[model samples]
Target: MRTTRNNNVAISCCSSSRNLVYKIKPLSHADSKRLLFKRIFGGEESCPSNLKEASTDILRKCGGLPLAINVTSSLLATRKTEQKWNEVRSRITSAEGIGSHMKHILSMSYFYLPLYLRSCLLYLTMFPEDYEVQKECLVHRWISEGFICGKDGEDLVELGDTYFYELVNRNLIEPVEVDYNGKASSCRVHDIMLDLLIDLSNGENFSSLLSNKANLARRIRRLSLMGNEDEGIIEQLDVSHARSLGVFRPTKQLPSLMKSDVLHVLDLSGCRGLENHHVRDIGRLVQLRYLNIHGTSINELPKKIGDLEYLETLYVDPGMIVLPESVSRLKRLTRLYVGTGTKLPDVIGNMENLQELRSINPFLQSTSFPEELGKLINLRKLGIHWRTSRSVGSSYKEKLVSSLCKLENFNLRTLNISFWLDEEDDFIRDFGFPRLNSVRTIRLWVGKFCWIAKCMLSHANLQDLGIMSGKIEQQDVETAGSISTLAEFGVFPACEGPVTITSRGFQQLQEFRFTWFNGLMFEAGAMPNLKELALTIPMYMLNYSESCFDFGIQHLASLATIHVQIDCRAVKAADVAALVCVLKSMAVAHPNRPALKMRTICEEDMLPDE
Candidate 1:
């Protein structure tokens, strides 16, 4: 048992049973300084000149353990004076020691955290070991549990964002994914940090993990049931006062839902065997504010869902088809996320507090849907998937575009428009798209934008784009590259022609993909900031009698990864085999030694004509 003195935790991490050999390797000198200085001052160059000597001394004592480095650097980030830095360094008793010394440093970092931040950090213990925590989900849970309090005019959610960043900044958690907007989308607690937090959490009985461990907390405020083994331990405890509940795996034992009158969060996401009956009593918890059934086997939400009047966020799987019309009565609901083809009840006008309405395929919904959406002045982000077996006519498209313009006027930050399948109609150009001044990310999942692509370049705030054209011309390339803020761009050309890329455009592009490969060539100065490139084309393009195509990828100075896709339909087996070898050789010759990945696909058993 992993035990600590004072407030004892019930967590059983049987050290003797789980003993496994680990080859602990120390960081090299350069890497250690990079980690330390980057954490403290963004980079070594930015670190204070006067404190450089003290920083080095502290790093030496850390002895290359990342935990030690992070804690020491975080503790000294606010103290810029050399005296304070040296005094802190002098207090370090390790002197090149690594064992218990690392724990001592961690303890200081934990204690140094502001009281509120310490609670936030400790709350992370609710997540299972090695679980990747979503920032939005965690923050919302924190809000539901009353952990965040802001000034009278301040937004609590935004305040919660600051708290999230603080934990990340302090290195108590590691960022797993950072979006183009530069916010960490998800994070995970480090093992050392998790161990420490788990102990603290159990001591306070702030939350409990229902595991196979012998010692169990009878009363708990928050609880997580990770596996089936924990199911047997459920009836042994009481969760009447629990405010948050996270169910990880499928279980017949869903404890105390009827008794948890104050429960604010019910997350059955990824819980495989969850069925309709399991959540039938969910609405009884009138104080509930957040519900996440994503990836669960549940097919429908109980009609009692509307009884939970305080619910603010409702997330369900796209596969769950039945959306109770009574949901329109949820006046406090701010975010509603459903999958494609899941037509929301037309009562959207009732949700005045709605800030994000995900995923309405207007083609499948009533004509009044977009009109209802336009009135939502609070809607800041919209996710749309346009899907249809037959065309939905001009009226549908016109309403969508008009609503988008209205939403933009209300300051929509993100407009994510994806297609069930790529649409080729240049309909957007027929009825021009007016200025979208406030949208920061506009992803046109490549429906033959043709001439319309030029208009989007005018939006100075666009940082990422996925556009498709019937024919990618040099002029289009010039227009797109002119957007100084553009970082990720992908263009799928319907027609095959050489689109010679010149250095004149795309100065800020970091990731680029061009699906039309015929005559595609990269001039030496093209896409200087490009770190990844993906090229997709037919296998026949490489079957020239004289030679295979040369894409000129070597010109990309900063290229770090290369992905190629070959359409193998109706191609000779010999040709496919030869082109595979040729592409390998081409990747090997690149100066940057970028990692290469290739995909070959065919519907008819690969159509190997030979």
Candidate 2:
């Protein structure tokens, strides 16, 4: 959709094309107004009275296009005075007859970007349009590609985040899944913005794309192959100069290492038909820094992996194969991700550069594993899946605990442990002995809540805690609330029901998520600082009645967002709708005027209205 010949139409195109059978119309005036104000002011009611008319006019000029609306609003978000906003509108309105008003808007946003930011923005075009790029993946790639750097004593990841948020502020990319940390875990590029980026990237030979629909020019310094294109395309394109290659859903048409001698990144995360032979020669690419085959069919990693001396991040998916012993030689590897049930060689301790090791089943490792783990003096984040089904020697347990304590004394910032056992053990209860003040987030899940939680609550720096408890007593809840630094808390002490939270607890808690929403009640003064509440309920457990909604949620002094997910299996649509209405009414009645979002977990065999 384009602006009408009269220059009255405000929209460019929707985020994606669906070719719907039914006609789709542009947003209405009211909808446009809300979208514009929401982006700039967070809500329509928050828009300044002085800027109301200007904002509406700007939105009208946007012609109900979300892309245009976002860019316009983002531009205005920084402009505090009336003059700057009107000047922007004048610039937008002046382009009415010259060319695409939308392109002018997007171009203004792009050209305003600094030279360094521009390259990073163009890098996003390598991803298929509408792809949601994980923030961690993108930031790391940006660092590896030399798109961003840090000064002395500055964290590169944090510096890269500033660039990410800047683009988000300029509406070049859309941030997604903003969690309790107030950081976007991932982001999406609008199709409109992507189109501009592709053109710019191709014009400068910045990167190349390989797909059925498009291909960049011959000098491919960075190449991205998307979709299962005919294998012949790989032979047709020249990848000799390529430094980075992202094979997204590729059909095993990977370029030979002989062609890519200086490759820094080889991301075949979800490629199809990617076999062990394809990655066997990874060591030959001595310049490689990031290798991701996380979801590929490649099961056996070649022994040559340890030869990549400069590799910083290695991601693999292995099934019942022994990791190459030589991996310990890659002293530069900082992050390692392995599949479940994947075994690591006893030499893990030799890879001291490792900072993040995840999903490692500590129970399946040898006695030397703990000694090796303790050697990772730089380890910042660790994830362990301890299944009680596996038998472990007492010596191994002692070593594991000693290793964890060693990490606590050092730089372990996040500890995540998941335990699944049919029977309880005192060992799991005593996992946390001394306080880990350096840790900011800790998630421990045992079959049942243990008294160890009281010890965890005593940590000085802990801010986020999530745990699973089988039968949590009222005292456990009280003990949890005693943490002064706690910000977000979640507990699934299921198998027990109908717990009441009085105002005496959670005075500093801001976000609370509970699995069994049906099992909790809120008193008048409960969780005074709480702002966000997410509840997941299983509907078959109880019959719907007027009293079912009497959880006294409105009493939370600062409540602002309520998210309710109802399992609709065998539940009636009318009941779901009825629940939504009551929640909306409650939100409307709250002093903070919180917003309510309702979702049905399962909609199978939904009963009709009676």
Candidate 3:
């Protein structure tokens, strides 16, 4: 049973089966001050000057407010005779800036935050700047790995939100200006706070000490050592310092540092000097969960590499690498990622617990798909990339599809099939994926355009469908019949796809996207239900090479969002005027779907759609 308290702001769950009861209370002024002081002073030696001043300034800033000044002063004296006036003044100025910027959040009452909550908040500092920290994504990651607590007693989403807000109130995270209903669209930690977090996480006891200073030992859990010319880690490590460690990087042969008792995640991608000795050293990190040796000089993983029984994720990037025959021994691995790897060992199908297989290389040359791949019923997301077209003759493509059909009953959500299929071959036959009814998103990269219209119509539950580069012919009249019903559709132009789409079958689509279509045009009244329309390539006039083709807004009456790409050099003001005029006419006619949001991306700003 769940009980609500504090006017429905707080919830407490009492469950006899789970033996759980939990309550979270708001912070009072005194409590806020106490926590601020505790956090600031505990790591004072390592904390930046601006942070210490920010902590002290919060106290005095609150004093100017109506409610906080009346609180008892017996807790800490107002040091009237401060000898370090210079430090105090400088800190006060910086703290004042922080206080000014976060006035609304700071005024909110604090809560009794748990240590784990603080740790989780601090860990975010390790990410690069201006990251969009999806609250749900973070919560799922934590819950999956046993980092969060109290899931049995309350809604995890609400608890996660509360902790996130608390962290924000404590001035640990700053939200980007964009918000959807007060939820952060993006977030970033102030650089000062990030430095503080890095210092704390990569403590002197745990971090791989690269310098003579042993102070950075225990604090580092995940180390990302980039670049080529780094000195050997043996001279840098102070092994007496480690407490918690996760990753070591730069793909180097750092055996002295690698021999640490705590290192868990290793990324040895792009290191040129790596050899068999490094692979042997990697086998010793039994607790290792992720190992990325992509782009390294090591061509083959040591046979003993499978000894790390706990490893769950591995990325061998751009190494043109191959695995030892013993890789089938890694029965616990859930994710196996190989980028630019030449061939996969035939024994990979022997591992039954494997859940994901991804390869990102255009140069992959494995001709036949392993029959054993069908054994991986637990696999959910599969991304295979291969260049060059071989029609349906490639048994590898058949095996890939056949393997997918075997996993028809699993809870598979995403399947990316990027294979070369010819126009005449039936890619989706009866032995086709019947169990893919659960699949909500599917991406197909058929080599020929004529295969698209037929391929788009087959999937049952596909809400999002992407078709990339094949010759698109307008011959199939019934093809448009399937597209009208799609909720979302994307097409990368082929040399011979539909030249003119004048059909009424596209009435039910909510989103319709086209990319690089040299000669494609939507017929009048084609997309009535379309809410969003994205055109990746500019519409140009056939006769005038320098002029742009214009689509008047009235043609897309139901579109609420329109995104188009235009060449700045080729576009004219009259073209924009024509577009606006078309939009104005559409707005005047359809009063309900007014204010069509239009955006144009030039070549300089355009990014390839994923």
Most lDDT-accurate candidate: 2
TM-score of structure candidate 3: 0.60
Q: Against the hidden reference, what TM-scores do the models get?
A: 0.79, 0.85, 0.60
Pick out the ten consecutive residues of candidate 1 with the lowest summed lDDT: 1-10
lDDT of 2 by residue, 103-161 (tens): 77887778767889998998897788778899888887887788887887466777888
Give the candidate order by descending lDDT.
2, 1, 3
Report the candidate with higher TM-score, 1 versus 3: 1
lDDT of 3 by residue, 1-610 (tens): 4543332333233324334545544455566555444443443354445444444554555444322221112112232223432333333332344334233322221112356665566556435444556564344334333455674535444566676765654455776643313456446775544544555545422233343235443444444333332465545644422322322234444636455555555555456667656676667666666676655666677777778787766777555466776777888887777763456666666777777777643334344344666777777767655444443353555666566677665645456545455444454432334445545554556554444444445666656666665545565423643553456777765545435556456656777777644455667776667777666645342232322334334466566655555443355555545655664455556545544455554534333333
Clashing residue pair totals per candidate (backbone < 3 A):
2, 2, 34
After best superposition, candidate 2 residue 417: deviation in angstroms?
A: 2.9
Instruction: In angstroms, give how far residue 572 of model 2 lies from its true place.
Output: 2.9
Task: Please give the range of 10 consecutive residues that has the lowest summed lDDT in model 2.
Answer: 3-12
Cα RMSD of predicted structure 1: 6.5
Q: Which runs of model 2 end up more than 4 angstroms from their true locations? A: 1-66, 69-93, 96-99, 211-216, 250-252, 318-321, 386-391, 421-424, 607-610
Score candidate 2 by TM-score against the native.
0.85
lDDT of model 2, residue 310: 89
